[model samples]
Target: MPRWFNTAGPCRADHHYMLPALRRLPEVLPLIGQESYFVLHAPRQVGKTTALRALAEELTASGRYAALHVSCEEGEAAGDDFAEAQRAILSRIRRSAEIYLPAELHPPPFPPSPDISLLGTALAAWARVCPRPLVLFFDEIDALRGQSLLNVLRQLRSGYSDRPTAFPASVVLCGLRDVRDYKVTTDSRGHLGTSSPFNIKVESLTLRNFTRDEVEELYQQHTHDTGQVFLPEAIDRAFYWTQGQPWLVNALARQMVEKLVPDRGQALTAAHVDAAKEILLRRQDTHLDSLAERLREPRVRRILEPLLAGLALGEVPADDLRFVQDLGLVRLAPAGGLEVANPLYREVIPRVLANTAFASLPPQSITWLRADGRLDTERLMEAFLAFWRQHGQPLLGTAPYHEIAPHLVLMAFLHRVANGGGTLEREYAIGTGRMDLCLRHGPDTLALELKVWRDGEKDPLEDGLVQLDGYLAGLGLDSGWLVIFDRRTGQPPIAERTRAVAATTSTGRRVTVVRA
Candidate 1:
């Protein structure tokens, strides 16, 4: 059995690999047939390159079309110099065609240094001699900037009429954003006219995450190959945290099968999954780091702030919206809302951005509330109240996370106390307008709800207590804390006040309100 999963795709050894079969959508296969110029897009590491490469291989192997996959990423460092970028692309294709296709298949008829643009001549030439119709895949096509990308797309458009005969029959522009979002500048006017570049795309396909069942199926592959069975909850946790993002799903499974699980002694479990998540996030591996990088962009921040606050924005431009979605920073909610893409992202992105704010605090001291050395809910909240009173405002400002900074800081503090020293479970939903922190210490469990309240509004205590009480009762828990940050209070010193359990709901749930 192999020691690692193929996460990046295909049979490659250097990149982490996952099965190529899982990434391709059935809808894309038909589009490949119509000789259409389509777009395949997703955030980095979502397998755009891998899927296209595998698809190209699949199509070419069928002997139906002459499929070729070429990467535009190689020329990306050339910057906005469209000519240099075009040269890089043509040279790359010439080399790939020679290696992958028959030598007699005929190279593109363009002159080595043509007076005309290399893109048009190259496509025209490649079509003339091919024994069969051609399928062209321009991977990382978005890497081309300004006129270069526009030129390539427009050249393809001009040649579209010759498809299945004089030009490549089918073309795919693969990148992070859709071709339509491209703001190509032509003739120096910066106008998106009817005949502008990048206007000739048909199908737009996004490679989606593995479904819940697909995740289990992939894990079953590992188990069958290596005899490493994942505990049921391990699979559940994997789906919950990653939502089947290809790289993360494979990475988690790889680490579990290879390192986290004991040597054929213990099954993989949720506890292991939880710990592995922290390890992967803390390592700031390339995948996680890239996701974190998008948060720093101003456009990203504009879209994300309201998302974090559970407020909806009106009429966001399609480009900025797609940009964040492509980055995997947000996901489409089932009810037509936007949400953080996944649980791990929701948990870790803030920490990655807000590391400085959290780092400034002294390490928290965890005291087991029970004499039997288990999690102490009462004591934890006691610690949190004091912590919030003294350090909440400073932490909020310094925290790198722009959204949900206050709530996450409090959770970080609680995690430092509970998970850091004792045992606790953290649960949350993206874009759900609420944060749920559950701490389990031995037989006792603490469920805390955090919210921000507007100053002019009436005391949320009545509603807050009812909510917390019901949440606790549902779990058969007697006590819980509902902490509401008074936004009207601004950054003032903490109120250091607590509302005792003076009231009971009709269902008899106990609720304690804390304003710290």
Candidate 2:
């Protein structure tokens, strides 16, 4: 009876609050009209399927083409068995046609022949008999791999000439990547050989996430439907956290409207959005969990290690960077270089990197909390010193990205602080040679800066003091912590060398410098 935000599957206008699918992907219909095949790609859960299905329905409804959307995902299980994959794909086409098209427009049953050519042959048979020109969309095209994928592509390439009558007038291959990237893992025996399959594609289009204005418009739908409103600040905070990520945009709103504050009488506020973020991050729902899982990938670590440590990137491969970008983990900043795509990802990445150390951390003692729940920074420092002396070295060894072991360990300890009723936020840029952290508990705020000392580098203390001073200036504080980790060879043992001393910045701000 009421529409809601959808996070799990394709959005339906009747049941879900959604923008016009065609508006997000306006290039599709014109491409189809030109009888051109193309590729549409974006990361998982970004509304790829919903846009394709919506366009297909509109085209079929217009009586211009017998449009049908089908998925090649079912063929993934066939692996190198291209014939089996072909059968699975063809079966789906017939089923989709029967359910969505009139009998006169539905595809005919498959021919007796079954092999790598079966997909091409079956589509040709359907096209020849259907009264209207057919347009097809093959969703999850990248899910097919090895020889199976190669054959599917080759068959499509083979069918390119017989169009508008002998075959579907237009074809779209939709997935998480450009088909050209598929060559990386494809079986060499049946190599795709330089765009032979999808080379007919005139263009490649990507569906973008909603803009801030789009997000506002989407939330306004709730106001129209139920007489409830999302306050302006709530809308702003939600966009800032999600960065217009489709699943996150819908998921965060769903969390507030469905679970956090179900009452339509109460106006949603920024606090509700913040609470929803904490729940989403803590629960590590399927979407976030899948994102965290990407951290284990070696390519991911290669990019993130230097990012966390605020050091320059090395000779990383372009394809690897593109692949990570395609996965929506990082984006090229307007100023250049790369950054984690959104603030939420920026937080999740480091926490996930440090999860191992957090697990092995000793149970937290309440000594770090003041009577009124404010953080006792001095007490927390004492606890950290004792903990670092005993466990920091071993915990450093457990860091998933070794280059930023110290950063991860410190984050792990701070995470323990956050769990005890507070929040810890991180900020760093490649080549900054330092990471800044902000910890808040009730009314108390603590700022921390981390630096690594190595064999050839100058003493980072002066630079760290300056950086920490600037950080303090931003938070309007007079004092904060600057931690320097000695990672050079032949250094004194960590337990023996660890200590904290007071220092001053060039600007006369006070700093507590810890050397380990």
**Model 1: lDDT to the true structure:** 0.70
lDDT of candidate model 2 versus the reference: 0.86
The TM-score values for the models, in the order shown, are 0.85, 0.96
lDDT of 1 by residue, 1-516 (tens): 264675544444233335655255787777877777888888777666667777777787788888888989776766567778888998888888778776666475565645336777777777787788889899888677676676677778888888878788888888777766554553322323333465567777788888888888877776766677888899999999998887888878777767777576568999888778867766777888877777766667778766665545556666677778876788887887677888888766656655665577776665645666766666665676667777776788875544567766776675565544444344444344455667765466778876667656776666666667667777788767777767665445564443233455556765566775
lDDT of 2 by residue, 208-281 (tens): 88899999999999989998899999999999998999898898999999999999999999999988888787
Best by TM-score: 2
In order, the Cα lDDT scores of the candidates are 0.70, 0.86
Task: State the lDDT at 432 in candidate 2.
Answer: 93
Best by lDDT: 2
